[model samples]
Target: MELNTSLDVVPVVSIALMGILLFVLGANVTRHRAIRGATGNQMPTDPTDRMFIAQRAHGNAAEYVPTLIVLIVVCALLSDGWWVQALAVVAAASRYVHALGMLTSKTLAAHGPLRDLGAMGTYASGIALGVTAIAAFA
Candidate 1:
């Protein structure tokens, strides 16, 4: 495990934060749903409020696993060089950006192609890391 360096965990932990955020918020919102909730015949305490939490959990691992794997692979297999570090940073930053973009999607001003841009950033960052890994260590 020549490449099992601490740097590999940074991006992974960052991604884990995103998943945790989504899970905590999403499960909270879901539990609040009145359907088959607490009482079978009574309305929720707040009937007018619907907690709309953004589903940034990637819904499942299949969604975010690709990005996570790319980052981990690059960090572990690629040499500890500037390119690897930069790519990992991009991936980390993009995850936060994407989550931010999603949280603001309901706003009239934020509902547009820009929301997709954050995801694009993540994809582009992963692609860059893959390419760098191939170019530098393959």
Candidate 2:
């Protein structure tokens, strides 16, 4: 099968935005580590700690962002439907919301509305993207 060279702009923009968000979260973690390094706890174990929250926020984004981006890109390449674009936007937005929820929350153990919404959006969009890609073949 021939590849489509004319890629949709929506997925490209979405991917770029998500990449920026991931880097920002990563930098936040690095900043926290640097600021807290003098205390000799480079790897904080407390979920309530700000440093730990930053780490988890970045770590969580790291876990989900790449997979979502891959799915978005695959869907974009396979199909040029507007639904694919919507999925990319939702996936990226959900990740950002999740990171915001993680950073702003007092603790990681408890559920927050933003976190819950973001998780739901992420799961929904991810499944939709997968189905969209598979359906492209049918």
Candidate 3:
């Protein structure tokens, strides 16, 4: 199978957006930590704490974004199908939604609709991208 030499705009945009989101989340965590200087607890254990929430939001994005970006890039490289592009967009959107949910949430332990929807979208898009990549070989 021949690979598409041209750049895939959708996947590229999606990847860039995800990268930006991850960076913002990480910056938020750092900002919170810096605000709570040496005298304050550097590592907050409470889920309700703002610093803890920021840390979790950044950590969660870090965990999922890299894998999703890889899957999106692989799918785009393997195939130039619209489905791949759609999945990439959905994956990126889900990550944003998840981050918003986490940031807006009062506590991490409680279930939030945005978080649930984002998680479901993430799973669905990721699975679809993986399947599409595998099918491209056929």
Against the hidden reference, what TM-scores do the models get? Answer: 0.58, 0.94, 0.96
Clashing residue pairs for model 1:
none
lDDT of 1 at 28: 49
Error of 3 at 99 (Å): 0.3
lDDT, candidate 1, 41-89, per-residue tens: 3332332333332323233223654565555566556566656656665
| Model 2 misplaced stretches (Cα beyond 4 Å) | 1-3
Can you rank all candidates by TM-score, best first? 3, 2, 1
Clashing pairs in 2: none
TM-score of model 3 relative to the true fold?
Answer: 0.96
State the lDDT of candidate 3 residue by residue for 20-117, as single tens digits: 99999999988997899878987988989999999999999999999999998888888988898899999999999999998999999896999888
Q: Mind giving the per-residue lDDT tens digits that candidate 2 earns over 1-138?
A: 344567798899999999999999989988987887777688878889898999888888888889999998888888878899899999999998998899999998898999998999999999999898888856
- Weakest ten-residue segment in model 2 by summed lDDT: 1-10
For model 3, the stretches where C-alpha displacement exceeds 4 angstroms are: none
Error of 2 at 36 (Å): 0.8
